[model samples]
Target: MTKPAYIAITQHTKNSKPALVYVPTRKHAGLTALDLCAYSSVEGGVAPFLLGSEDEMDAFTRGVQDETLKNTLKCGVGYLHQGLSELDQELVTNLFLSGRIQVCVASSTMCWGRLLPVHLVVVMGTQYYDGRENARKDYRIADLLQMMGHANRPLQDNSGKCVILCHAPRKEYYKRFLYEAFPVESNLHHFLHDRMNAEVVAGVVENKQDAVDYLTWTFMYRRLTKNPNYYNLQGVSHRHLSDHLSELVETVLNDQVWADFR
Candidate 1:
């Protein structure tokens, strides 16, 4: 018997319709977008026009200092990232959503909440930069799932595809992470201090008890409580929580209060 081209479905559901397209990096995204444009032009006919007016597209093309990227845009390919101006990002996103652009080379920033119902989603890399660690690390299961969710739009198409491309060493890891449906781990502990401080500064919470009570109602709290063993936070003492809360209170109280002199 001949072997199959791809592996058998491990954990896919009827509702999970996104085709995950994974590449290695932002550079790969660009290359892949160009390749897609080339293929589409040859197989699918002329490329669609960009979303904006000719003048707007011209300005955008000129504004891009990267000559190669500018030329790519002419081929109906675009990229999205925080580095681009808000207008540029919006234009690219709109173009992709309208199907005016064949492919969009985007960073993970596009994966959050923006709804671009594309037939395919290509994840360039499985690892993202970890600011805390000052190094690139594998994406968490939640983030990987969230990115894939962007591609699976049942309203537009009953099914979509997400392709993930990773290095050979990391291929098995990606397979396990995607095929096994790993549970999402919470990062509240990493952001707890910053969140409390911001809440105190914004006047969202007044006291330590208020902070604790407020957190208890959040989804993170509920999830963590339910899976304490997996999270390993069962031993988080009240004293530690109180200390962090008290520090937040002090910082907020000490800050200069803005007032209207009038």
Candidate 2:
């Protein structure tokens, strides 16, 4: 006998009158909401699905003078916000797990470890870079993996029915970049040295001077030896930071500043 696949049911009512399409790109995120209004204006009866936060909905509702959007589409559109408490998370998860809301527009963060039955997953620009001081950082592959799990589920009648919409330029996007940011998890070293570089080197930094020296040498290697090659280690640059390093810096800096003031 075959094991049953994951099936979700909820008390949330489905709006079968229309379909909901979630967009990930900021350029087109609002298109679904706007198009619904446009279609409603001409068609007269069919309502379009609108997905946004309450604040977003409010702003668009107030900004647009379109009668169909303001009245009809606005009523059809649903708002989803991350301001949910733990209790609210359970409620929303139940709604999703139970298949209550027909359409939802959400950030990728919402997909992390969430059990929701979604018909589609859309990915926008994966290359989100942050420039801070003299550093540049790329979005983590772990972060992308977390979002991609939105489409993964046990095989069922509708389990493989999910569709992933990506940008035209990103037709092979996932293949190229899904594992870019997660070098360790993505087994990048295996790809580079074919398991020759799989060995992990452990060291003990006995003192603050040792830690600082390691960082200084790493900085020099990255600047002089590696040249254009980008290397980020904790305390070397804000570009890449581990949780412990971030906390340690914050604690030390705050303590020193406070002590100096006193």
Candidate 3:
């Protein structure tokens, strides 16, 4: 990720256009920014990202709390994440937009939070920890798309650039999906019990029949008929639909029965 990122920074620096780098976590965001600065110096880069003098740079980074981030900024790089204060976020964001900094590294979740646009974008990694599932999981296509969007600056640059660094095994997977418009299967089943419980608490579901009826008006129900294979339906028959909904209601109610035991 740092190799490709350094290359990106080198290429864009010649044109004086800023770039954004996305990492998997807040820690990676800070470290990747620092590494990019290191790569710059090792390769005889005068910190191309730092466009201002030391006094001006110090004024720009007044209230920044993260020491590593401050150092990166001095090298003409900035970092963003949820851990930073709003004041610091706004400061870094302004630095990027005003072209004082040439690069900003951010966490995956920050893709939606900040609206920083650049001539280039490099996704450090595609996987992030899913606390709910207690495992590392691939990023949602929506979030990845949003990250890619940062590269294109409308009416400013003729074109945009993106470099995604993912595992070799998933190369083809990303290549296919990035260009193809595949149908999105319903993920309701992943947390059907929790969803059903919410509805029950809201008085929208009162009985077993009510629960099944609720599923009928869902995206899951729509996809059930279109892609029966995805939801593991044996056949697209009335009996099959009824059986599936019945099983779903049973699972949801059973979970509610044991909700507090664990």
Candidate 4:
């Protein structure tokens, strides 16, 4: 899939608006934003912000010093990655919330936990962990929800802006999982399997698999009661648990934005 050049574009308005662009890397993409504004028809301006060390900011702000590429970077404008002081972080949060900054080119670290509302939170791609024995690594579903929550804020339009998923099918599939997984009352430990994941299915069940089975059946039974045509299945398995849980996801998606929020 083709990754878009820009993660998000901000619309300027009377209200101060801040935009958050989530990129996989800090240095390369942050600087690229500065370069894109030079040639592209895209409006507003792009500024780069770095999150690591302070010494790197000088060369970064100056752009590539090579004589060949110097002229191309002359028009570049954006924040550089000076280490974020606590006050600096607070200030960025405020600027973002107030919409003062037109475009913020930030590392995913900028989103470590800050919940600044924006038009869109575009996740371009992610790092993969490859070990010698096995090569499999991915972001946890809860982590993705936490990232997406930055956009699910109280909106000026009253109608919320759409959370768009582009290019990546894996990301889209996770998005659907998150939408279904949102409303349920579960903590980080529960979602991650660190804590016991239990549901009061029917009378009572104490074993983990039994609890999972009961809970899964209970959720599906509730959905079938509401709309019999939603889905049909003969049995369940660890492999297809997500497919079965999807019906509950549909109910949760429209039932409320978040039970906690309400």
Better of 2 and 4 by lDDT: 4
lDDT of 3 at 256: 78
How much lDDT does each candidate structure score?
0.58, 0.39, 0.87, 0.43
Relative to the true structure, candidate 4 reaches a TM of: 0.44
TM-score of each model, paired residue for residue: 0.51, 0.38, 0.71, 0.44
C-alpha-based local distance difference test score of model 3: 0.87
Select the stronger candidate by TM-score from 2 and 3. Answer: 3
Window of ten residues with lowest summed lDDT in model 2? 1-10
Alpha carbon deviation, residue 258, candidate 1 (Å)? 38
- The list of candidate 1 runs beyond 4 A from truth reads 1-70, 129-134, 181-262
lDDT of 3 by residue, 1-262 (tens): 7988788667754667888899999989888988988987788568767877878999877678878888889999899999988888888999889988888999999999978888888898899998898999999989999999998889999888888989999999999987887998889998998898899899999999999999999999999979998898888889999998899889878887888676
Clashes of each: 14, 3, 2, 6
Q: Is candidate 1 or 2 superior in TM-score?
A: 1
Q: Which residue pairs in candidate 2 have backbone atoms (N, alpha carbon, C) closer than 3 angstroms, thus clashing?
A: 9-98, 10-98, 12-100
Best by TM-score: 3
lDDT value, residue 237 of candidate 1: 66
lDDT of 1 by residue, 1-262 (tens): 0001011011232332222234435555566556655654565456532334555567667766555567667766776655566766676666566555455666665566466665566566677776798998887777787877776666677776676756689989888866686566667655666676788779987875687676666666656645766545534466644454455445544442322222
Clashes of 4: 6
Q: Which candidate order results from sorting by lDDT in descending order?
A: 3, 1, 4, 2
Candidate 4, 1-262: lDDT as tens digits: 1124343332322243334455545454445555445433244343332222334334433434332222222332232233444544454455445543444445555566565665555554554334664764555555555556665556454433423444465766766775665444223212422122223233354543444454454444445434433345434444454555554443433343354378
Distance from true location, Cα of 117 in model 1, Å: 1.8
